[model samples]
Target: EFLENYFLGIFTCEAILKIIALGFLLQPGAYLRNVWNLLDFTVVITGYITVFAQTGTGIDLRTLRAVRVLRPLKLVSGIPSLQVVLKSLIKAMAPLLQIGLLVLFGIVVLAIVGLEFY
Candidate 1:
């Protein structure tokens, strides 16, 4: 818990510095145009909500903890190759789903054929 809190603090401070450097509301366009900025904002907000909800409401927010796991994705935004790969995966998801269904249908047909042979 202590390590997690430490890293969260680091990320929170980093996000704050980024917002300040970006001039915050003064240049919203510069800040929002990059997908990485969006990710940073999301992770920071989720972190704050997790901390506040845990302390203020006296309730465990497990879901917010899960959201915090997205911190590693920050690294993804730093790498050009990873960004291309991530984009490709996102763009391919629909076709991949269709391929998966086709494979499943083939498996079912093979199973039926085997049963008949038995």
Candidate 2:
């Protein structure tokens, strides 16, 4: 628990500094404008919520703990190459989805023909 809180504090400090350096949401390149920063902010906020909920709020926000798992993804923002790869993957999603649909349709048609023959 000590290590969890320690890391949480570090992440919180990082978020605060970034928010101060680059505006929150109104500016052109605000902290929340970047997808990775937005994700970090979410994980930090959820971490706090889970901690506070457990301490005394009794709010039962256990589900929020799952958001912490995304914390490692914040590394993508630190590495330029990784960011490039991730951006390309995201861009490719639409075409991939179309191809997947085409394959599924072909399989379904084959299944129908096989059933009729049987």
Q: What TM-score against the true fold does each predicted structure earn?
A: 0.77, 0.81
RMSD of each: 2.4, 2.2
Output the worst ten-in-a-row residue range by lDDT, candidate 1: 23-32
Q: Tens digits of per-residue lDDT for model 1 on 34-104?
A: 78878877887888788788778988889888986788887787788998998999999999999999999
Model 1 pairs whose backbones collide: none
Q: How many pairs collide in each candidate, listed in order?
A: 0, 0
Worst 10 residues of 2 by lDDT: 57-66
Q: lDDT (0-100) at residue 29 of candidate 1?
A: 61
- Model 1 lDDT vs. the true structure? 0.81
- What is candidate 2's lDDT per residue for 38-116, written digit by digit as tens? 9989988888888888998768875787787787787787889998998899999999999999999999999999999
- Against the true structure, candidate 2 reaches a TM-score of 0.81
- Distance from true location, Cα of 51 in model 1, Å: 1.9
lDDT of 2: 0.90
